[model samples]
Target: MRLLYSIVMLVLTFSASADISGRVVRVLDGDTVEILQASRERTRIRLAGIDAPEKNQPFGQRSRQFLTRLVAQRHVRISGDERDRYGRILGTVWLDGEDINAVMVRNGLAWAYRYRGKATEPQYAEPEAGARAVKSGLWADPAPVEPGLWRKMQKTPE
Candidate 1:
């Protein structure tokens, strides 16, 4: 089961890379964000390092609110590792030279996903470490639901 999970994760990591700079027009869930580039080029950006709760799951809206507070309708530069299954460009979002992915990790609002690739950007493992140590945001709660687990739970839809 672990091997299968790894293989599936690996497949998701191997993809194409594209560089684009644009404005963050919308925040889709937590990990996924949308950017509106010039010439009306709209690209969906998946946060490279961190994963947040799904919209319908617990803490979902809070995650979106956090993202909105951090970057709402602002200009951000996107550096891609690759596009994911949903056709969203997976990359690090930089706002004024600061990496939003790293920031999310530092805030305890996300987890450092272990997926690896060059198409994968530098999601330094330390951000999450610091966040966990300080107990920021959801981490302050006795227990916080992992985005992956939330995704799985939502799949069966009780």
Candidate 2:
């Protein structure tokens, strides 16, 4: 049974990890965008491996603006597998061969995504560290809040 489950998981991973190329039609936020494919289909992509500040959070607009400057109306390639609960494709966005997801973290505009308090993408650790050391972007805040924690705080009754 374990072997069968492993095989199924492998198949699902491969099927989901398709490469997509399209023009970035909109920058929804620091970590999300709308891509217009050649087929004229619009797909919402949630950048993999990083979580940017929420729209109302400090430096959130700047994060979005920076991402816009990087990829807005530009052609990009997305490589990833899986979708979020909201149906946004989870992918690494590449523009001019640069990893936009890593850029966001390196610039301190976003945090390396974590699941259960563990970093999901180890490669981002060094960049995030460097950004912190330099006090870049949101890191300049004396006490920057992680987006996840901020969300939970928002839901708690005042």
Candidate 3:
């Protein structure tokens, strides 16, 4: 079992290190996008380490629009190797050499993605703090809800 785990880890590491170049074909939401790779494959990527508002949530459409303005139809480099349960590639997107994930949070369009109430990536903390301090984008809302919490509320019985 340990050997199997090690092998899986190795494979994941290798894949994560492999960079894929593609052109953004669609922006599914603030944190999700579809890209057409040079190999002619369409890949769905979930921006790593950031969470944006849902389509129905406050600032959701705005978040998507912001991302669209940044990467729509532009060629980018994707650097991530893991696959989420939804079969989407979990990775960081780079456009014009800028890290889009960090940009989203820094601009207050998204939050540093958290797992179990803890931040999964530390690099986004400072950006989030700055955005919050200035009330930028989604932060302008006095009581903006995190997308995860919003999702739960949506599923709860009223």
Candidate 4:
């Protein structure tokens, strides 16, 4: 049993380290997408270091649309070192040399999600600050509800 556990752990480690490249097959939302590899396998990826609004939240549709317009059907490169609890690869996405994760934040389509005591890179931070300053997209609301808070509120009894 111990040997089996060790082997599983080793495989998981190696899998996480593998770099990924594929064409985007679907845009599930502003921060998630399905990529289809040349081998016909599909991998779900969650855009790292950012959180866009929930589908029902304000600016949600626009966020999805923005992402779809940017990368749907395009080949992308993913350099991720981790996966989220949901088994989605957590990574930075690049399309035509553009950082799609940062682009979403810069356009005010998403928020830089600071996790584990580390804030996102300046690639995400500077644009977010600029977007907030300009009142772009969701920031245009007098008070926009954060995606995290919005998710919690959705589960509470009204």
Cα lDDT over the full model 4: 0.91
Cα lDDT of model 4 by residue, 1-158, tens digit: 99999999999999878779999999999999999999999999999999999888999999999999999999999988788999999999999888899999999999988665455655677888899999999899999987888898889586
After superposition, candidate 2 runs with Cα above 4 Å error: 1-15, 156-158
Question: How do the residues 1-158 of candidate 1 rate in per-residue lDDT, one tens digit apiece?
Answer: 99999998787666334468888889887778888899788888888767776777666788788988888889999887666898888888899999888887777777777654221234456777678788886678778777767677668645
User: What lDDT score goes with residue 85 in model 3?
Assistant: 100
Give a tens-digit lDDT track for model 2, residues 1-158.
Answer: 99999999999887777799899999999999999999999999999989999999999999999999999999999998789999999999998889999999999999998998778988888899999999999999999999999989889576
Say which candidate scores most in lDDT: 3
Better of 1 and 2 by lDDT: 2
| lDDT, candidates in the order shown | 0.77, 0.94, 0.95, 0.91
- Total residue pair clashes for candidate 4: 0
Residue-by-residue lDDT tens digits, candidate 3, 1-158: 99999999999888767989899999999999999998899999999999999999999999999999999999999988889999999999998889999999999999999888677988988999999999999999999999989999899586
lDDT of 2 at 15: 75
Clashes of 2: 0
**Least accurate stretch of 10 residues (summed lDDT) in model 1?**
115-124
lDDT for residue 75 in candidate 4, whole number 0-100: 99
Candidate 2 weakest lDDT stretch, 10 residues: 12-21
Query: In candidate 1, which residue ranges exceed 4 Å CA deviation?
Result: 1-18, 115-123
